[model samples]
Target chain A: GENVGLHLPTLSVQEGDNSIINCAYSNSASDYFIWYKQESGKGPQFIIDIRSNMDKRQGQRVTVLLNKTVKHLSLQIAATQPGDSAVYFCAEKSGAQKLVFGQGTRLTINP
Target chain B: EAGVTQFPSHSVIEKGQTVTLRCDPISGHDNLYWYRRVMGKEIKFLLHFVKESKQDESGMPNNRFLAERTGGTYSTLKVQPAELEDSGVYFCASSRSGQLGQPQHFGDGTRLSIL
Candidate 1:
């Protein structure tokens, strides 16, 4: 089955440094991609999203880069903070309202 | 505005016991979705409802799992004769529309532990 997968299961970064998470998807028909953050004891929260038509999209301190040619997506966070510690997942819209999610990457911040 | 809200943050039941999970989506949001994460696996979609109508249910694991959205306001997922594999975190999400770019707001989720 076509799926979305992450490059790393866990990542540790120093505070104030930048962090990057990578995701690879197999379904080329997916037209929309999103990034979500999940803290302990909570559900996945929306972080940012990018449309297939565009290759890059930016939010407050986050940027989502989409490479349609390679079917790869990356989320870059500027100036990692303590609150940034969580599991980050990349999801692609498979159908009208169905989202296919990756295994997720646990991001830990070093203070 | 209040985001998606789910009832009974956690549930513990035996293998044969039945469990019903409820979700109250944001007001006026007609699109509702159900998803679950089992152990180490990624979140998987279960079903989707559009204004009390099931738009898609291809992700439903089996007939043992039933979902209903009455009046297109709140929805419930019922698992009867649950099995050990039914244990996981069930999350409910809602969006104002089914548009391509609309982001779905999620609830905290209900953790079900099947013994």
Candidate 2:
């Protein structure tokens, strides 16, 4: 079965430094990708998304880079903060409304 | 505006007991989706509803689980005679429509524990 997977299960970064998370997808037909953040005892919150037509998209302090050729996607967060500590998940749209999610990466900020 | 809201943040039941989860999507959003995450696994899609009609239910594990969205407003998922493997977190989400590339907003999810 085609799936999306993360490079690492956990990541720790120093406060004020940048952080990057990587994901690889097996399905080439996927056209849309999204990043979500989930805090403890909460739902997955929308972070940012990128369309397959574009290689990169930027948000306030986050950026999503998509490599269609390699079927890889990465999320970069600038200036990591304490509030950034959470589980980050990358998901790809498989069909019309179905999203295939990767195993989440737990990001911890070392203050 | 209020985001997606789910009832009973947590549930604990016996293996043979039944459980029902509810989700109230954002007002006017006609697209509803159900997903679940079991222990140590990624979130998996269960089904999707467009308005009051089921658009796709390929992900549904078995007939023991049933979902309904009456009047296309709120939806409920019922799992009868639950099993130990049924314990997990169930999440409901909604988007503006069936349009491609629309982001789906999620709810906090209901954590179900079957003993």
lDDT of model 2, residue B75: 99
The DockQ score of candidate 2 comes to: 0.50
Which residue runs of candidate 2 sit more than 4 Å off their true CA positions? A1-8
Worst 10 residues of 2 chain B by lDDT: B96-105
Relative to the true structure, candidate 1 reaches a TM of: 0.95
- A1-111: candidate 1 lDDT, tens digit per residue: 111233448999999999999999979999999999998889899999998999999999999999999999999999999999999999999667988998888899999
Estimate how well candidate 1 is docked, as a DockQ score: 0.50
> Each model's DockQ?
0.50, 0.50
lDDT of 2: 0.91
The DockQ-derived docking category for candidate 1 is medium
